[model samples]
Target chain A: MTQASPEQLAAWIQRMAAQDERAFAEFYDATSASVFGLLVRILKDRTQAEEVAQEVYLQLWRKAGSFDPERGSPWSWVVVMARSRAIDATRSDRSYGSALSDLEARPTAQPLGNPTPRPDRAADLSEQRELVQGAMESLTEPQRETIQAAFFEGWSHREIAKRTGVPLGTVKGRVRGALATLENVLRPQLGEQSMGGD
Target chain B: MEADRFQELCEEFLLSGLEGEELRAFREELDRRGAEGGRILDRTMEAMGLLALSAPPVDPPPALRERLMAEVGAGTERRGESAEGSGAGSTPTGPSLVEDAPAEPASAGAARRDPSGPGHERPDIGHSRLDRPSPADAPYPWVRSILLAAAIVAAVVLGAWNVNLQSDLSERTAALEEAQQELEAVDTLRQELATLREDLGTIVSPTGSVISLTGTETRPDARARVFVDPQTGRALILAFDLPILTAESLYQLWAIRDGEPFSVGTFTATEEGPARLELDSLDPVAGADLLAVTIEPAPGQPAPTGEMVLISGQ
Candidate 1:
C-alpha cells in the first residue's frame, strides 16, 4: 500500500544505474512493495509470486537505465513488468486454463455507458470484487462477458469469438469498447493520471 | 486520413502483436498526435489492463530489501562513492545511522574502526593523545595483540590498495577508450543491419526460412535464432535467451562458406539487455550449412579458441 512518487523514484533509479547503493536501496524500498503486490496478485501462488518478484527487481536493476520517464510512470512500468513476468508464469504453470477461466468469471457490475468509477471515488478497494462487480454491472451483459473473457481468460480475439460464437472482428470491437467505457467510468474517480511527461 | 486508418489498428494495438514497419509506423503516428494519440492508444491498453483485473497485488518478501541492497551495494562500491556514511561522516556528529549498523562487513576490517555507535557520535579529536595501553582496560593481551596485528595488516592492505586503485583507474580509462571505439564499430554494424531489416521487412516472401539455433553442450541456455532472406544474401540473427557476456568475453558470429566456417564479425549484444539481434547482410550459404557462434576473448581473436557456444543448421 506504500505508493512511490514516480518522478522521485525515477531520479533515484538514475543514480542506481550508475551503481549508487544507497540510491538503489531507496529505489528498492519505494517501489518493490507495490511491485510485489502486483506480482502476487497476478501470480496467485506465494512461492511463484516471490520468485517472479525477485526476477522483476533484478530486471529493474538491470534495466533501470532504460526506464523512460516519458513513456509511462515508473509505478505503471513496474506493474507492467510484474504483469508480464506473471503472464509468463501462467503460461509455464500449465494450470493456466482454470486460472484464466476463473478470472473471466470475475463480475463487473457497473451499468452500461457509466464511466469507470474513479480509483478513489470508486470507494474502497479492499472489496475489489464488489467494486469490479458494480462497475461490471454497468456494462451491457455481452460487453461485460467479452471484456472479462479477453482480459481475464487471456483469450485472443479469435478465441473469444469462437467461444462466444461471435465474429472475431466483432469480439475485438467489443473488448476495446468495453475498456474505453471502463476508463471513462473509472477516470473521474481515479483522477486524470496526471500522465506527467512529454 | 491516417487517424482513421490508424484507428483501424485497434485490435492489433490492444494485443501488442504488431511487428516491423507497421509497429514503427504506429509509434511515429503516436508521436505526431501526442495526447490525442495517447487517448487513441488508451482503449487498447485498457482492454489489456482488464486481462489481469483480479490479479491480486502480491507483496514482495520483506527480505528483498537486504538482497537488493547487497547486490546494488557491491556494484556501487566498485563504481562510485557510497552516499550513506559520507553525508554524516563529514559532520562533527561523527557517524550516521548506517554507521551505527555493526553488522556490515566493511566495518570489520582493521583499516577502519567504525566509530559509528550512537555513543561515539561526538567528535573524538581528543583521543589522538590517549595512552596506547593500560593493563586493566586492555584486559585481553591476546585480543590487544590481535588488534595490533590487525593494524599492521591494515597498513599493508592500504599500501596494496593504493597500488591496486592506480592500476584499476588505468584499466578503466583504457576500457572507456576501447568502449568508445567499439561503440562506433557496433553502431556502423547496426546501421548496416538496420538497412537489411528494412528491406527484409518489406518482403512477404514464402521462401524465407526461419531457424532456431540451440546452444551446444557448452552453454545450454545460450540460444540464437535467425530469419534468412535467401534472395538478398541476408539473415537477421535474432539472438534470444543468451546470457550477456562479460567484458573479457565477446560473441563472435560465423557464416558457413563453402563447407567451412568464416568469421563474419565479432561483437557484443546490446548493453540495454537482450531482445533480438538483426544480423543483416550475412553471406548466404546453401542448404543444410552450419552457422555458428563461439565465445572468444575480448577484442575478438583471429579465430575462436573459446567453446562454440551455439550453432544452427542452415
Candidate 2:
C-alpha cells in the first residue's frame, strides 16, 4: 500500500465524485492500509475488520461527493468514517458490548489484544507517528488512558467513566484536555502539511 | 451553553462518545452556533484524526483491493451499458464534472496544496476553541474567579450525589436501559422532524431554489421537486408518482451544471408514497443549471448511466 499526499488524495476523491474509476483505485491504494489498520485495532477481530473495511470502501466509492475538503483532510474524513463504522460494529456486536459492560466492573479496561505491528515503512508516517506518540506521552496517564479508550476501544465518555470509576464530567474533561495538548504539540506540523500523509 | 462545556461535548462528538439525549443536546448547541460551531467541529475532527495516524499501519490482504476493484469495475460497465441502452449517449466513464465551473476547483489539485491559498487560511473566528487557547485554558481574572466558584459548588453537589449514586446504581442501570430505548424512539422521531423542518426551511427561505422535475417521455406521470438551500449548499428531493425500482436497481439524482451532470446520490421510491432524499453535499447546485433523475443499477454508479426518467423544465 503506497501513501499519497493529502492533496493527491483529495484530488482523487474529487475525481471519484465524478466517478473516475482509476482515481478511486489510486485513493484506495493510498489510504486503505491506514483505514484497515484502524479498523483492525478497533474491532480486534481481523475478519470483522475486513468486512467493515469493505463496507467503508464501498461507502467511500458511492459517497465521494460527500467529501467536503473544507471540513477536513480527505485522510481525516476517511479515518473518521472508518472509525465510526467500526465503532458501530462494536456497539452492535452484543457479546462485545456485554463483555465491555461486564469488564467495567473492574477498574481497568479489557485489553483489545495485541495488534501485529507492521513496521512503518514510510519515513513521513514514522515521523508523524513519533510526533503523535511523543505528544500522547505528554498527556497525564489518566487523560491518555481515557482518550485511548475512547478512540481505540470505541468506549463512550459515559462508558469510560463507568470503566475507570471516574465521574462522567471528569472523563469529558480529560478527553478535551488531551485533545488540546495534541493540537498544541502538532500545531506546527499540522500547519505546515496538508493535514495528512503522502 | 458555556464555552467549556460545549467544547467538551465537541471533543466527545469527535471521539464518537456523544449519544442519545447528550447527542441531541450537542447537535442543538451546534445548530445554535451555526457556522461557527461547524468550523469548531471541522477543526476538532482534524485534531482527532491526527491520533488515528499514530496507530501502527498494516497492509491489507492484496485480495481485498482486487475484490473492491472488481466490484467497482463491474458497476461502471453495467451502468455504462445501461446508459447506452437508454440512448443517453453518456457513459459511466470519464469526467462528467463541469469544465468551466468545476465543482469546488480547490478539490481538484492546486489550491488546497498551496500554503498561501485560502484553503489553508485559518480564520480567527472570534474565539478559537480548537487551536487557540480556550477561556478555560487562559481565563481572565473575573472568569477564573467564576470558574473557581463553580468548581466549589460542583464539588459540594457531587459529594451529595455520590452517596445516592452508590445506593441507586442497580435501579439506575435498569432505568437507564429503559430510558435508552425510549430515547432511541425519540431520536428516530427527531430525525424525521429535523428533515421535515429542513425541507420546510428551504421551501420558505428566500434564497432557496425550488425546481420542478417533470417526467420524461417514458414515464409522463413521474414527477419530483428539488428544494435547494444555496446558503448550506444542500439539496432535498421529493419524488412522486414514480415507478418504484426493483431490488436490482435504484433512482439516481443528478445535478446538471454548465451542461455537465454530477451524480447527487441514489435512492429507491416507495410503492405507496413519495420517496425523499436529502443530500448533504450537492454544493454545485447553487450554481447548477438543471436537475435530473434516472434509473440506475443497484448500489449506485458514480456517474449517471441510465434512462433519464425526469428532467428539469420539461
Candidate 3:
C-alpha cells in the first residue's frame, strides 16, 4: 500500500488544522484506503466500516488542533481512532457475538488489492511492505496468532486467553514477547522515520 | 516500575489490553516520566502502526469522497453565512434565503456533477423541489416584509432555545460522567467486598483460627485481629483504631513462636483507622503462639526495631 511520508502527512495535518480544504482532501486521499482496510478487518462489515470511516475523517477535521506530532505520526493517530471507533461500534451492536465469530472465520491471507501509489514511489512502497511482511513472518505461530487476536479482534488479555484456550498469563507473555520481537526486527528496516516526530 | 515492566505494560497499553488499575498506573507513570515517557509510548505506538500497515489496503467506495466533500462544502458555507450574518447585523435576508431555498435539488445537482460517478444519495427530507412555492403564489411586498419580520423573530427565539439546549446538554453530560464514575467506584468496592468475603469464609472454616490482638501499654487504644488457617498458611490481618504514623513510619505484623518473632507483613493505615492485609502464602503458623503489631521505620525491619503497639492478649 502507498503511504505518505511523515513530513508530507504532518504538513497536510498542519494545514488541515487551519481549515485548509485542499489539504484536508489530500490527507483524506492519502490515508483513506488503509484506514478503511484496517476498519473492515476489525469490524468485518464494509457498510459499517464506511460509515465509521466518514466519522473518523470528520473527527480528524474537528479535532485537528489536538494532533501533536511529538506524540506519534498522523497516520498512527488516524488508525488508532478508526480502530477504536470500529471496536466500539462492534461492542454496541446487538450482533457483537456473531460479528466476532464472523471476524474469526474471515481468512487472513486473502489479498487486499494494492493501493495506487505515485509512479515514482511505487517501488519504495513495495519495498516497505516487503520489510513489514518479512518482519511479521518472523514471529512464531502462537505469538502471531495471539497478537492478531488482540490487534485485529480487539480482544482483551482474558478474552484472547478464552478464545485461544491459552492461559491468561501465557497469552500476555506471548503478546509482550511478540511485540518486542517485531519492534526489534522492524525498527531497522522501517528506520527512525517511522518514529513519527519531526 | 522497572524499565522492563514499563515496556511490557506499554506494549499492553498499545494493544488496548491494559485496563482499570493497570491502565491508571501506566498513565501515571507516563505522566511522571514526562517527555521521556511520552517518547517510549510513542515508539510503542509507532511500532503498532507498522503492524497496522501490514494489513493490505482496500480501496474505499468512490462515493464516500463526494459525500464527504459535499458535507464539508455545506459546513463551510454555513460557517461563512453565520460569520457574515453576525457582522452585518439583522440582515435577515441571508437567513431568509436559507429558509426559502430548496436545498435538496441543489445538493442533488452537485452530486450528479461529481466525477466520482453516481454518489450515495442521502435522503431528501426537508426541501424537495415539489415543496417549493410557485412564482404565481409569491406573497405581496408588504406580506413579504411581515413574513421576514416573523422569520427573524422565530430565528431569535430558536437561537435562544439552541443556547438553552446546549447548556442543558452540557449539564446532562456532566451528570452522566459523574454517575459513571460513582458506578465504577461501587464496582471496585463490590469486588473488594467479595474478596474479603472469600477470605473470611476461609478463615472461619474448621482449619481456621482468629487471633485478637489488643493494645500494649505503649499504645493503649490500638486493636487488631489476625485470621489464620492453621492447616494452610494463609493469613489476613484487620487492624483498627491505630494511631496514624508519619510518612517515615509503618505498622508491621509479626508472628511470635518459641520466644522469637517472624515478620508477617507491614501496612499503613488511613486516618479513619481500618486496614486489611492479606498474606496469600505465609510461613506455617501452626506452632506460632501469638501475633503482635509494632511501629517501625518505613518498609519495616526484618526484626522488630520499634515499640510494640498491639500484641495478642495484651
Among the numbered candidates, top TM-score falls to 3
* Runs of candidate 2 exceeding 4 Å displacement: A93-127, A192-198, B88-314
**How do the residues B210-268 of candidate 1 rate in per-residue lDDT, one tens digit apiece?**
77778888678877767777665445565666666653466766666666765544545
Q: What is the C-alpha lDDT of each candidate?
A: 0.53, 0.67, 0.66
The chain A TM-scores for the candidates, taken one by one, are 0.62, 0.77, 0.79
Shift of residue B128 alpha carbon in model 2, Å: 72
Best by DockQ: 3
lDDT string, candidate 1, A1-198, tens digits: 434444566678787666566776777766555566556655557778778776777667766776554444455455555565666577754333332222123222311111332222222233322444455666556677776665544455556655766544345445644554454445444445422111
Task: Give me the runs in candidate 1 sitting further than 4 Å from their true place.
Answer: A5-34, A89-137, A140-145, A152-154, A193-198, B1-11, B14-16, B19-39, B42-54, B80-314
DockQ of each candidate, alpha-carbon based: 0.11, 0.16, 0.18
Candidate 2 overall lDDT versus native: 0.67
Runs in model 3 with CA error above 4 Å?
Answer: A93-127, A196-198, B88-314
Candidate 2 to truth, TM: 0.50
Worst-scoring 10-residue span by lDDT in model 1 chain B: B92-101
User: A152, model 2: CA deviation in Å?
Assistant: 1.0
Better of 2 and 3 by lDDT: 2
Residue by residue across B34-95, what tens digits does model 2's lDDT show? 55555455566666677887677778888899988887787677556656765444333332
lDDT of 3 at B219: 75
Better of 1 and 2 by DockQ: 2
